[model samples]
Target: MDIDWPLLTGLIGLCGVGLLLAYSASGGDARALHSQGARILISLLLLGVASQVPAPWLHRLAAPAYLLTVLLLVLVEAIGAIGQGAQRWLELGPLRFQPSELAKLAVPMMVARYLSDRPLPPTLRDVAASAALALLPVVLIAAQPDLGTALLVTAAGMSVLFLAGLGWRLIGLFGALAAATAPLLWFYGMRDYQRQRVLTLFDPERDPLGSGYHIIQSKIAIGSGGFYGKGWLEGTQTRLHFLPESATDFVFAVFGEEFGLLGAIGLLLLYGFIIGRAMHIASQASDGYGRLLGGGLVCTFFVYVLVNIGMVSGILPVVGVPLPLVSYGGTSMVTLMLGFGMLMSIRGHRKLWPA
Candidate 1:
């Protein structure tokens, strides 16, 4: 097994925390625990398989994988299962998975492969081409009305650009352009509920029992935990069902409420270590493809943690981003673990491939 021990250990630790939180959040439901456990095992299996694959193979599959994912996204738009008021999943009989989850890996992989053979600090033409590659799927996903996943996919592709030595001036210009279009996006791009969510972030109390309910309850649950938490299964908010999405997006709040500040910090430290280790692997990769792909995947993973923690902690709008391994979900677990697997592959195969 050519595994990266530190990274794998951190992942397993987070998964364990997830199981603990899931059990508590579900009020000790055996079925929920079993299902989540099964998913974790499957995700780990995929990670193991991915880690064994060579970097060159990943480089070869990048374009095809990306194209297939985009095709799936289009299929999602045409004939997809609608869940939670969004068309994001594609159900093939007993198998139901989110194509957008695949985008998280595909977009970055495709971008990294494209830029690898090109010059560093990609020229205007190259940047435009890369942006098109990213935007195509992003547009398709946004049309699915899955703004969260769309934004995440965008971030994943942008990370590749950033890692490819994209200039600071270009980045600043892009930032300014995004800012300038914020109003247009607000008025024309955002749905009513999405706008409400953003507004609720500033004043969650405004809707109290309505639009603000989730964040407001999450804040109370987290705040009541104080420094040492209320202890496992003793969380009033979770036990009494005051908290919503306790087993999914808001699971972190349940964790904070049960385990307190110390546990939260410990969990974050574990996450930090995994991210740091992945970055170190990326830094040591002998090829541009390996470096960009590894770095981009890790950056996307960082954003996942940031957005989920930010939303649950009342710092950002609730965009339905799960708390990585700790949140109870299947596709997300698989996608993230697969990314880690690819990182391990990059590290494990460094000596075999020349720069």
Candidate 2:
């Protein structure tokens, strides 16, 4: 059977743009550009391999894979490298990996597998059971203080349970409880610097040279791009080093400053197509498992795009979300490819097995 070329092509196109933007964003740092080129090649190779794997195999491995990631997360906390006030990465000689990215796929896979044939309109017992499965990793990651990824992973897992028929009354109750507890989570749950990030989202002018500077400068860079950007590598905000996190969390600002609104909108449109196609695949899947797995993966993919762009453009508070395949990181690329692989796995094997 022929693979769905559009989804594959769309992902490749997004990554290609990411490489170009990464190059321009880095101010001709030859090392970064060369490294990005190599990473892209590796990512493509992984994508190809993942595309051929079976969904059942992926489902089978979910529990073990997720447990491994959790163990690594806990291990990282115990003896991980500390950077920027958080222990989020595990050093691999020349590489730094984040287990949280792996959790993005693992958590959803485990949940989809769990709820595959459970009764619709879940019982409180099911909801409680599912919540336990979902929150274990969330609590661990949050302890690393990577709130951005922790939240995204939670959303992905909850999406599956929602598909499994989590009660709306329960959802609303959750919403209210989350809102009420947000204050305590804010004042006590968040570190001082994290609290600063939320405050920076509002009045960036308060600390023009501190936590607020990143957002303020990002806005300036995006605004300066206007209709036709400053031209690749010519972005003053990034090339001149005004925009912090230019190559990572704030990568979107660099893209806008160099590629302009047209480029920005074009990028958004590409994401729209990729996500739309994933949703289409989910809808067409043969069974409850296939459908929930595909749909939940789609939501996870969309969150990667949304959080990166939103945080960079100042729409959402700054979160350390990478731009899926675009951002520079091993774990993000691996997790993203795994998600795409699941999509491919679902599409590739559906014809052979009965739902």
Best by TM-score: 1
Task: Give the range of the ten consecutive residues with the poorest summed lDDT in model 1.
Answer: 346-355
List candidate 1 segments past 4 Å from native: none
Candidate 2, residues 195-222, lDDT tens digits: the string is 8888888888999988888889989999
Write one digit per residue (lDDT tens) for candidate 1, span 167-243: 99899998999999999999999999999999999999999999999999999999899899999999999999989
The TM-score measured for candidate 2 stands at 0.95
Candidate 1: give the clashing pairs: none
lDDT of 2: 0.83
How close is every model to the real structure, measured as TM-score? Answer: 0.99, 0.95
Q: What shift in Å separates residue 124 of candidate 2 from its native position after superposition?
A: 2.2
Predicted structure 2: clash tally: 0
Q: Where in model 2 is the C-alpha error above 4 Å?
A: 91-96
Clashes of each: 0, 0
What's the lDDT for all of these models? Answer: 0.93, 0.83
